[model samples]
Target: MVDANVMKKTFTVPEIKPLDQYDFNRAKVCASVRWLLAKSYGSAENVPADLREPVLIGQELQAGVSVLLLSPDLYWRAHSQLHLRGVSQGPGQGPGGVSKGPGQGPGGVSQGVVQGGDHVALLQLLASRGHAPRDQDRPVTVEDLQHTPIKTRAHLALIDALMSLAAMETVGRVKMAAEAEQIGGGSPWENALLFWVNRLNQRLRESTEDDDDKTQTCTDLQPAQPAIRYRKDKVQSKLTPTFPLVSGVKDLSNGCAIAAVLHYYCPSRLPLEDVCLKDTMSVADSLYNLQLIRTFCCGTLQGCCPLAVEDLLYAPPTLHMPLGC
Candidate 1:
């Protein structure tokens, strides 16, 4: 089924514009990129018709991949509160033994030797997660992403790929909380989420304390309150999701919960005047809330990944976040 909500998320109220095709309108793309650049130090570099600035885009993609790779593991470790990767062989040779060469001196323990290019790493990440690109599709090179704007349904597919990846890690713990059941939850779908949540919330506490935010965790459900609506609808908006229970997935979907979380940690990123705690059924309002959340993630949070507005709007259902991480 075609989702009509594509390209709708914006800082302002979403207008539900009809798409001529799948790609983002150049005007919108240019505007957002320019805004991203403007925030950086030095004069904002205007993105010309040729989106020729490859370095930043490449770096950003690499950064996003790294964030995705690391956060789930961090969540897990925080939940466990112990070094789960402890070697059965003990410290034996120790963690990193410098390679001693016969002819020369020690090859001083190889520090920070991260392999794989960002392009390959991103594709591999997607492939590993079952979001592999199609064989019929042409490969997207730096040239294609930077110099040549896509001209078919490719852009839409690409956006789907990104949206598939961006839901968790960067935006806030809220998205992770929503999908908590999937990440730390066991294989084939099951509590890893709550386990992770308890850990993360604890890690976030004043001290390196325990994750005790049960009411807010996904495992436990909250009640029908005017503060949160089950769904973004007009007629049935007030209805309680799952009646007896509602996880963070539905309760925090509008992005308001994320805003509240950000305000506590990074007040400067989201001003109090900008935050609206009340439940909002408007698509634009929801996207704006997510925009604010994404802004905080990409800017204030350390090691936080970046995601497109489309990604925030169309986040995929949570899945196992690769235990082999």
Candidate 2:
């Protein structure tokens, strides 16, 4: 059972500051993206010595790989309200529904609506910045992405890694949801729920495989088979269940990271997949606490500042110290 104390704690929005205040934060993110791109597509001299050989060799073998980047506008609009201050209810919760409280069930992995959208925006902005010398001034488009080939093997490897991450997240969410329901019903070990959840996941995987098979068959029969058309609205409505909007920031981060990494390495392939959720409460909590520390430090010193990247990547030391020390 979820602790009542945990459920009672409110999740406040991070304070809004002027865009200039976040310059360091934004620059750090952009720099990481630039580094990843350089490693993936740059010439041997441009790439770090350690990565030069692999990147150059990979370029020759991974020529025709493609990725599709889907627009996140629908997702952004879906969870726009979650960013507002003092809004306690989680995204998509109806009246009197179970609110996703701090430390309640798998809240640690819950997606932050604002952060996810921010990542999407960052990717789009970076993609607009062109890759090659001749194409650097030209604007990137969906058409450009569809036809472009991935230049580096590392970039393709990263995409595969992200797919694995996304699959893990999908499985985690399904298991978490099932566990929450089981706990809510006063039986933590319900065999039926466990079996049902497993069955559902298996079906989803089978459906994806079936779709791939059908697509391959359709490609072979394209010349003789007439195109089937449906109203846009009807198609979208049918797809709504399969493509949920409440995706976690980690997944969004993965997409943005992939896009930024591939923009220069493989402009032709945009990463695309069905949208899914991620639990990000733990990361959010860490950020919130870090900001609080920064606030205190700034108050003590006139302008206490540190590299945002260090703060982001820092991990708390796990030490076994004596109490007296």
Candidate 3:
């Protein structure tokens, strides 16, 4: 069933008239290339070396915001904290590793690379525990996850994924707490909301750190009541207006990708934005399998536009509408 809120947005008629820009030639170019690359290989890292400039140009045209297309697997790692939950290796199983089911070889152990099956098993296990399985077609259980054996590299990758997720959450909460009242009901969309909050808060902090008065104001704004008063007493409460958690997903998704934007801030800096998961398709697609419920954030459109709910997976690469529109 479609989310009712998501449904309503599809019919929304925008109130504000469109305004002209200085020529988003740069932004358009970047967005187009980013979209093409993401769609072609289901990852931006696969973007050809030659077209990178045009893509950056497109991003400039679209405003400073660049529509980043990520490999579904990398998308999960960055935006969804699903990888944090370690792969279950069965009941009473030790950390060293032992095969619990089929495919066991000599010494009743599994060896070699950790395949996508192992990841899916972990997802299934989590879903059963949470009772939030996305797929009705493939029924799986925690028992299955407990039996999958993953290689050391996959294990380490999972750990790194978890750390990244935690960092995003820790930072996001810091930002959210500052404007808790402004955030409406419901848990922040379980995927990317927290990540955005973290990035915006980081930017706000970095921007104001050098200014003593600004620093004091930000610190003073920490407590809710004091923050309210500070808002009245201080002239600039809107510097980075607390991002209102609306009944949509664009803000959260954009926030998660801010790190990517930061990568492009200066030419001298290395671009880590194009980094891809070692195994992109198989690993990422497995998340959608009944065993794993990991949600990837890409092409997630959200904003004041009419088709805000039209997610990246569903729409075309380039559009005249706003990035999240």
Candidate 4:
């Protein structure tokens, strides 16, 4: 077991600079971090550096969003509150007191208002949970923003701005792709995707080889149950481990790049315009592991893993399309 003190010692908190000091782009990212820290730590100022550093890296806004998405505690809390507020508000008081039905916002204007409302609601919720500054009556400044509701609101707005920018960038790329020659096979997006995919596959292969070596070394210590041993050996031999369809892209930019590539080369593959490739990858990875576990468990019980009815309706598909094509 690891020592708690050693673990604590290993953790370092990154410096949370004044929000004003960060240009608009960075401040937006920091805002998401602040919101997360505020949820977990009660005060954004109290957020540990170790947790803050990763979100601060490339595509901070997306990183921050990913953090929230992965953490049920944070995601549900914010989402629940947002949902409650949306339902409680009167018809005329639609996000920011601007009257608009669901999906009827004035393009960009209502988006900004809705985001502003979300930030305020989040900060208010945090404040109720004792995360807000005690000196609520005091004049708000950049430093004060860290522990104040205003800071939370600003951070929320920043998050919205960052998302809008990302959407615009994606649209611009799609438009460019339509007008330009097929991004030659050597485009940067394709190269990056290829690099990450190859790296993942290579690592997987290495890990499998290591596992096989370990299994051989541990053969002498095998359990006395012949049935168990046979099942384990059979499962190991029969399992054809292939990379899951959506396992390669790790970050938002890479996910978007992959999506763009898909849209450019095989448009039918994308079912949604605003498809979150990262989320899809996450789901695919989960399903792949679950299927493997189910197969192993059922095999041990002398039963077969049952495929879903939908899966049986179609022919078994390849893990993914060839990268070279």
Please report the candidate that would top lDDT against the real structure.
1
Stretches of candidate 4 above 4 Å error?
1-153, 157-198, 206-237, 245-325
TM-score for all models, in order of appearance: 0.35, 0.17, 0.28, 0.21
Q: For residues 1-325, could you state the per-residue lDDT of candidate 1 as single tens digits?
A: 0011322332344433343432333323322233322221112332232332322332232233223223222111111111112312222221112222233221111222211123444445456555544424765432333232232233223333433333222222344444545444233122433334344434333221221232244543554332222223222333221111113333344555445545546655665335443323456556666666666655665313223454344432321121101
Instruction: Write the number of the candidate with greater lDDT, choosing between 2 and 4.
Output: 4
* lDDT by residue (tens digit), candidate 3, 75-175: 22222222233434464332212233456432123342121334453344334444322223444333322323312222222322333333334434444
Candidate 4 residue pairs in backbone clash: 13-49, 14-49
- How many residue pairs clash (N, CA or C atoms closer than 3 angstroms) in each of the candidate models, in the order given? 6, 12, 20, 2
Q: Rate the local accuracy (lDDT) of all candidates.
A: 0.34, 0.28, 0.30, 0.33
Candidate 4 Cα deviation (angstroms), residue 158: 5.5
Which residue runs does candidate 2 get wrong by more than 4 Å? 1-20, 24-29, 41-284, 288-325
| Top candidate, metric TM-score | 1
Instruction: Tell me the tens digit of each residue's lDDT in model 2 across 243-314.
Output: 112121222121222122222233233211211112223434333433433343345322122223222323
Per residue, candidate 4 scores C-alpha lDDT tens digits across 1-325 of 1111222333221232343443443433443444444433433334455555434454444444444433324422333222222234455443223245465442112322222233344345444433332333442233433442234444444333222222233333432333222333433343334454344435544554565555554467853221111222112222323322323322212233333333334444432122222223333223332333233324442222122211211212210111111
Compared with the true structure, model 3 gives a TM-score of: 0.28
Per-residue lDDT of 213 in model 4: 56
